[model samples]
Target: MSLHLRKPSFVLISGLLLSLAFTAISLISYYVANQSLNQHITTNTLPLTSDTIYSEVQRDLLQPVLVSSLMAQDTFVHDWIEEGEQNPEQMQRYLKAIQQRYDAFTAFFVSEYTHKYYHSTGILKQVSDTLPADRWYFHSRKAPEEFNINLDLDTANTSITTLFVNHKVTDEQGKLLGIIGVGLASTTIKELIETYQSRYGRQVYFIDAQGKVTMQGSQFSGASDIHEVKGLQNIAPEILSSPEGSYTYTNDNQTYLIKTRFIPELSWYLIVQHTEQSEARITTTLWINLTISLAVIIIVLLLQHFTLGGYQRRLEYMANTDPLTGASSRHAFEMLFQQILNFAKRQKHPVSTILVDIDHFKTFNDNYGHLLGDTILTNVAKVLTQNLRQADTLCRWGGDEFFIVLPNCHQSNALLIAEKMRQEIEESLQVINDQQLHVTASFGVAEYSNDETTVSLFNRTDLALYRAKSKNRNQVEVATESAFKTV
Candidate 1:
């Protein structure tokens, strides 16, 4: 096939081809060099930046949740409700005790089941919103143990940084008591993520437990609504899902480095993003290199009439093998299987086919997210390649599945290997975004018989796989004799 064709003299055409070849080589080299440099810098800096921001946010967010959880379980609150009477003096004493434990707790406040803000620790006080005769907190006083009674801050006040933890104080039979709540400054959380972003010259945002973007910084502030940014959804649904992973994306004609981690204690997500605006400026210089390459090609074409070279026939054989997995493609596998069949006819040795399907790969994509899915696929491919013998072949069939040709192996041997693969993949945990994803694979094994043809062997293997999947996935099963007999 002609690499290029533009009408020109023989000498010019030959020189042009040579110039084009050199230019291609030069372009490839430059791309490799640039990527390596970028990767080196990113590798050195990204983890430190991600960790710093994550640590800062984690402490701030967890502090509130922990304190709230602790207070909700406090013995004093339970005792007070069981006493069956509201004593203003006793309530003030309990509030003072809690305030001493947490310095951030500037005041201890109470709102009754009727929503009256009547009691305070008297350490620090504030103006209050109107109370309802029967408020949401009244229901919390009777809530089940599993239910978290943190007040939805938006329901109480939009202007203040506040979190309220309410618990049921019941008698032996579960009676309601007055509701207690504490409000704190929201500026504390704002300062937490913002402080780290400022320190590292990075950008950070905090999404609430419900997946809403609650806090964002100046660098990320351009997002009219952070939820509208496609990149955030591209990662896991929760930052805690993948505690640490860094990927690049292009947005609004700009490239960004995104790192995500989850805060389990607070059920919040921390996201750090960096724009590679400076990198884009460096990349623009690549166009200049292309122009210089074109000019050099013109000169070479003038001198040699652009003579060119070509590939050897052996290169076709090389092309058939997968460089990443070192396995044969469908075409090459078929050819090799035919060759094996011929050899077996002369001196018989049984051959088997194993079809392996990775289980819940969609969940991997959904849970840990897609980039990690690719990583899992690669790791699984490597594992399959490692398990096969030199004489056998393993090929990625498509989409979280693989095909293996076990030459000269009995059904027993093939079944044994399949079971091993199933077990290993099941117990394996791949770390992505600081979370561990447990993955598994299922297998169907079919052996070739003297009566079976090449196509029939594959058909039986496929049928066996259908049976395996139907029987509640994640195990290996061999094709029954009846399965191949009809085929």
Candidate 2:
């Protein structure tokens, strides 16, 4: 009776409604599956990844801290500090030994008696209570912790970024002597993070309790503050307060899963974040069945990916290379310097550095305007490139100061090279607006010492450069070991 009463239009309308219901069910099922997969990843996979990171940090970063503590308790360090720290050469040699034995970036010591900061390079600076730069030493003196990890400029490697493991040095009576520790380059930490991120496809970063990013993987750049990261500000407060946990955050209509773990050793938070946007994309694709439209979307995505990849490569190149001189940038040169130093240490070969400063550069800039100054810089760089060996590295350190590194070269050879470079620069001419510009530069050369660090070598070389400038401009001076010993 019911079938007879139903009209054709009613039956058609009922069939449409049933189809719609099935479609809705399928969509809902897809959504559920996606959510389940993401939850599984956050709960199971992220914890494992976080554990791996923790283990690596323990092995690499914490080991240094432990070693530093052991050094603090060692009789040799205590005896050395107690002996008045009179022989800086001995102190320098001991610091160098510590650095070499542990394969640390650098080693340092501070003497409460002399109020002088000592490192592999000899006396770095005099610590004063009033100076802001010396405050770290004073603060460490009062801190209760046995050791602490912090970021500071690595003066040895041209003030490049470094992570310092500062440990308090004390005497047998438990009185504070000074401080001693090692440095790890920030580049190394970044590389470690980048490797893990690439292997596991997770965003990994280390942030301090104050929400400042101390270390991070290569995926993030430019900014290090946690609040600055996209989609992180909303959940940052909770993540900081909790020692270990997971949370979800949504930004720009996309969801992200975050896992946090506190590292007591570093007093920093280890954060791992995973985005669900990929899963969302998959869900969207499931609902769209237009073959041509799908193909078009894929093509556009491919184009965008390639374009972004190329752009990233270009940016990296620009960052590493000097824009005006086409020489290595300071940061890039520091990385290369470290590699060369390592190689030299292993091979027992000598490495030499030369610092070149353009003479009367300020006067020239004042007379000729910045455009001509830039032209002169470019011309000088060309002359330097022509004179240097292909294996050598030339860097525009800063403001009319150029640095060159020569591997497997001694002081005598480096001095000769510097002399030639000086002469070439003096003769090199830049013509602008029908006028010839003449430039002269001063050169300072220093060879790497077996027990000296890059910073010490740089300081010695800089002193030689100063001597050259003081005696007369456009001259080459080789740093004498006596100069370093005196410092």
Candidate 3:
């Protein structure tokens, strides 16, 4: 053969052999991996997800129990029961407060002696053992445990399913006096399941020891009995007998892994489900494989980044920003103060601080009402912010008081800035809630001393502000007036 023909033939043979070898090797590895992954998912992955869901559900359900326990031991409840339940309005108001504060679906107390059921709204009914609706109260009364959590419709109010936590109350001598507790709506539990499902891409439901489906999210059928479910019926008996275990079954020609855990607090089994592992698709070409893998990796990273980043940003904003005055929060200001101080020390620059307190603010708040009081605070902050340099940090140091940090500025310059801010606030005519008003503030300016800490600097400035208020209401004073410096 000629040289060109020989070369072409040799390349064709090499390519065929390479492709065949790769295909054979891939088949063996793929089969092995499928077995291992299925084992791993059944043993580790699905169970871990079940455990996480259990922990989150337990935390939420246990809170109502804790609150019910507190209500049971409350002195007011003890006193009210002993005094023959004289004030129904007071008890109603107390229950209302509990419901509103905790955002519970229902809050109630049933008197053992009188057999009366008092709801947050008013008296719902009188407890009687003969009535089917009041059997829960009786069950709670006879139960050995202090409390029991039940999922059922709240008959007194809307028939929407509610998780009721009924606790027994006792007197000083441990005699039964009443049953007290709160109810949580099913929406909360449903939302919890949906949240986890979105993250883990799994199905979740709850079942009792008797194989009865007690709780389930919107995605699952509201079937009352596990024995009714097509494939689940086969293993239902085995699962109902155990506290925790795993099982697999075929439904619609597809196998699913089920991980079950018993929650003693709610006396319910949490079941998390995952579909059986399938073989991964095989693709030829290293370039194409790399491209697909990179695309998938990017998507997963972006989702994680956004979820975590959004949460972190929200937390930081809430912690560091003042809601009312649009200034940095006290905590945020403290952190910035340390950073500014260190920068000043390194640059050999001056850092001055100013404190502004609205004169007669309490009396004004009392006279004009808190709504107008908040308006004045916000207005004062706006005026001060307008007068400040870009380097300055303003903080709502508390009610009617504002603190400012001026970096790379001397006390004299800070004094000028403070006086300007004070005068502008006094001059600006505010038309608040159809009422005309004028406001004045006392200003205290202090120069940072290297020997001093933040507290020392603040104390000196506060003393100066006190002097300004005592001497003349709408004026500025410097820390130099007190001659106070850190030793």
**TM-score for all models, in order of appearance:** 0.40, 0.50, 0.58
Model 3 error, position 266 (Å)? 8.2
Candidate 2 segments exceeding 4 Å error: 1-32, 221-224, 228-231, 277-487
Q: Which candidate is the best by lDDT?
A: 3
For candidate 1, lDDT tens digit of each residue in 57-164?
544545445565555555556655444435656667656655565654433444444343434433232223444523545455545552333424433344564544
Residue-level lDDT for 117 in candidate 3: 89
* Consecutive 10-residue window with the lowest summed lDDT within model 1: 304-313
Model with the higher TM-score, candidate 2 or 3: 3
lDDT of 1 at 8: 48
lDDT of each prediction vs. the true structure? 0.62, 0.77, 0.80
lDDT per residue as tens, model 2, 423-486 = 8777756454566666789999998877777788789999999999998788998899997786
Q: Clashes per prediction?
A: 15, 0, 0
Across 1-487, the per-residue lDDT of candidate 3 in tens digits comes to: 2634654465456445544543454344444566665665577556767876886787678668878998998866887788789879979998999999878889999999988889988998898999887788889899998899888778676659899999999987889998999998888888988876766667898888788887777777546888987899999988878889999888889888889998887788999988764564322322343343344334434543454456556667868988679999999899889989888888889999999999888987778755578789988999999998787899999889999999999999999999889878878834667777767899988999876778888898888898899897899988873456442
- Alpha-carbon deviation at 135 in model 1, angstroms: 8.2
Models ranked on lDDT: 3, 2, 1
